[model samples]
Target: MNGDWLLRGRDGRLSVYLPSGDAVLCRAELGPGGPWEASPRKVGGDQKLRPGPAVGQGADGYAHLVSWRPTKPGEAGLVHSTHFRPRLAALDWVPIGHPDKSGDRTGAPAVAVDGEGRAHVFVRNKGGGLSMVAQKEKGGWEPWRDLKGSDVQEDLAAVTGESGRVELYAAVPGGLLYWRQGEPGKPPVLEEAVETPVRPGTLRALATSADRTTLFYTDDSGDLCAWRPGGKPVALLASAGPGPVSAVRCELDGHDCTLLAQRSSSGRVAFAAYPTEQEAAGAWWAESGPQLPSDARVSLATDEDGRVVAATLSPSTGQLLLTRRKDEPGLALEAWREG
Candidate 1:
């Protein structure tokens, strides 16, 4: 899944979750830039899981993960698991079933936690529309609710804004579809669809304000673009490769900035830093770190010190590789280390 895999906990430690074989494995930091765990630990129970699982951290510091398991051709069942603190033990994978009772066909799922500390999962339904289920007050989940749309493509992006309202975005045939919560803890209402050409599987959302988010995606020409609600899409710069881009907001030399990372066409990771919500100012791109498989996905997160940490999977060995931004100025990264 193009969703986030790297997450920094409230205690300053980081956790990287990835699909290994039929299971989800987690390699967590002993501390910030840790000597991580000696080896990865398997999460959930013995149940098999589909690759590209989507992970998100809640306001309460728990890591929530969502993935699907194939039951038959064109049919899969969705399951979810949460990471408990102190022991770092993951709860058993609980099946959430499908939005469509007749058939389980669905796109990759995306998860977001609202301000009230409830986790919400969104996935494309069998009808090419969107369906969502959120954690209930005490426990369990509400029935799946269909947030209708047409020709909704996968790689859905979901983010909870500073105000505790959750926003969701999806790519359709000729444009993008958006959903926004009128208030915290309320269901999101579908906004008028914006007409823009977004490459499928490349949409991502980052909250830039208390009630708003900036959507990022690659255009038809593989150029990076950003769009905010009630505004037109702004082209940022050309990307080195065609895929989803990872973004996180942090301080750079005392200035608030948004750091972006993506896999380059040459199998190397590229980075860029732009003033937060200042896409009109433009961005400069540079390549850094070792070259990985051209198809390897990259994700970014900030440490307790506000430094950016990056993680990707080794295609050949299926191991986790990590690097963090150096203390020096600019977007320099430390040497890659296996977790």
Candidate 2:
């Protein structure tokens, strides 16, 4: 269970993957709205599996996965998977281009699918700048292109906007730097980066639209802060631990919900709900749960009914526990499956 993870595929399937020996194993269900019947499969080959994977679904209905693939001991390269259907069969993993010689020193790659159904991958270069490879529409990959930035943090986030426009963000010394790619064929243009009120620890970003990109990070004081591009960063009263954070768009009671989840300092999972699409930091963050253990890794995806379904690893059993809320005001949590 070294490389354990979960994500919601673009087609509304909730998939979970874990590392087994040298391969990354996967399983998925249609949606968490009903009973879950998991179908397990292996995604990678004999390469060692990395824990976290960046997943995105293309317009063509194929889910793309990017993770580190070890070529030799201590040397790994960023690998990309073919257009595998997450709700069905297994993946035949393939290295995007030539493997980077840096080996396991590379960081995890982030992927986003354009509106044109092309996949773009971003990974950390040995020299610290970000390296990217674009998947062509006709069925191939372009040579790796370096998108140079100064002192870029390993983690990069991307989102697709209108017409497949892409917005990429990386944490820098002061704040974050972003780039906008108007079209798949054009080069990316760098934009003005801002200095935050406090130095950020790690970054979490999601783009709902071209104009509505959301960024979150822990301030130097360890309080969670949220910001949009060209907007001021505002701190949330919610305190967060060092775990990962993510947000998704789902429907609740006929309104759009921006659901944010983070691990608390005490190790319990905390969820905050913004009931509207036009979200302002600290506007209205509602919390609920059947709280999870401190070490649990949480994954969120929307069900067919447009409600949020969360899965976390149970500490005692090491099994994946599914949590959800019913149509009522209070959250009704349940254990839908194990492992």
Candidate 3:
């Protein structure tokens, strides 16, 4: 599993997947306040398939979901489904692709919706290679294309670049390799891997603008690092735990800022904001937010109004907590409040 269960839809509604005895796919959605509502119906699958689902919402107000499913008892692959109509009464789960090898487990699929409202699915095949498929404008998916690299170390980080171009990144043997699609309907071209000073762990990325993106990763030394397109790798903070870092681009006090959150080995989570790209280049990391337990993973997304929202999963209490940072004057880091 890629450890992505909670996601924010295009309309700012948050949806989460939970385990249920009666169904394989049980989803819950919550808005700004009040209670959580169950999706119209439960989506079911084979008994052998694990619930490693990844979801993405397109600008057209359609939500696409992909999850690991067994082709048979001993073989595993990915299944694609979509929710388009106002009500989610029935979903069409299609058999998209199968693993390269039998009994091989595939990671959770990564999805990106382009400016044209086309959905792209990137999955790490069981052979440790990366492959992709896209949704056609009219209906159905195109053929699966193997982007070809047998050494991908983790789930891919992808974002829609400026002009509807797609960019994908993975942590490989010596460094990170990136691929950018030439244009719509053109094959993606792979670039040379850029070596890093420290061995990278899982990668997390977000597009700050059509032309700019910020990449974050946990290093072998458990420190948090940041990198941008064609920029030098910089360590943002030391002693960060092995947990994944969540980041997003938003307006902080009416200024563009990139907010980052990471957990520490001491069982506390800290958040910081870099008001400008130049400040982030200087590693000007200021601690923010109340300390949170280290066991949970954080997922961050920005709303239409530029509000930075965070969802954290607490393993000890089995609670999913939602928090948002307060917009205040000055450049100092501020505390986050529960909704």
Candidate 4:
């Protein structure tokens, strides 16, 4: 139930991936307003995985996924799989191994595809720092390399800017750690860290403009905040609940906007929309549909027509629930549909 679970493929069809029991399952949309497949497709074969697999789609329209696979007590590793085309089954999960050969504990992983269609995976390493592996020019993976930082928490955030350069962020004790590529396809360099009180597991990133990304997270008091590089954090909504918020930039009423969905403390899905990067203007949160499990994660993505598609698991039945933004205006949503 990671924030990256829902994605739109190149063909304009939407796909939702979630951990069902011990295996991951995928249900795809037939088309806009079309029904989802009756049966969920099993991804990565019979491999068992930790819940909340991270998924990212490249410019080529392929969906790439990474998840934690528990091995021995200290030998757990991350595995990766890809759907090369829309509505097609994904390849089997391949073990990417741990960053430390000495069997250090690994935290959750985050994946992002660069401008050149290479997928980059980042995770908290053994020493509470960050390590990464990226797809090589010819489709092979480069060895895991350390992208130094310390006291890092789980819930790492990674995003590829409109310029194709990939940037990463992690919550630390007193502030946040940052990294970015000098240019597309280049390795990321550690940038100046921002001093702010970011709640662990609530960090999320969205590219609001070309070459720039805005970070969203709940502050120490559980209030939502937004910040961009070289700028002070801007406080947004209050009581955004716990965990991360799913965000996507799309056009609303002919105006560019950013849509966010989060499971409120009341266990209901709430949504908010505002002009992209205009947080100071203000935003209002509206509860949507039915109540989900307090711990259930929500995801947001845009369909081919730029309509916001939202997904979450049913609290009672554990079924995949999906809804989309109505074409009329604002953040109005269609009825909740089960997959």
Candidate with maximal lDDT: 1
Error of 2 at 99 (Å): 8.5
For 215-273, candidate 3 gives per-residue lDDT tens digits of 77766765677778687777776635666777766776677777776665555565667
Q: What is the TM-score of each candidate against the true structure?
A: 0.95, 0.83, 0.82, 0.94
Q: How do the residues 179-235 of candidate 4 rate in per-residue lDDT, one tens digit apiece?
A: 999987778988869888877788889899986899898989878999898888898
lDDT of 2 by residue, 21-64 (tens): 45656677755443445545677555555565666665565667
Off by over 4 Å in 4: 71-73, 102-104, 314-316
Give candidate 4's TM-score: 0.94
Clashing pairs in 3: none
**What's model 3's TM-score?**
0.82
Ranking, TM-score, top scorer first: 1, 4, 2, 3
lDDT for model 4, please: 0.83
Model 3 is weakest, by summed lDDT over 10 consecutive residues, at: 18-27
What order do candidates take by lDDT, descending? 1, 4, 2, 3
Candidate 1 residue-wise lDDT at 209: 71
**lDDT comparing candidate 1 with the true structure:** 0.84
User: Candidate 3: global Cα-lDDT?
Assistant: 0.63
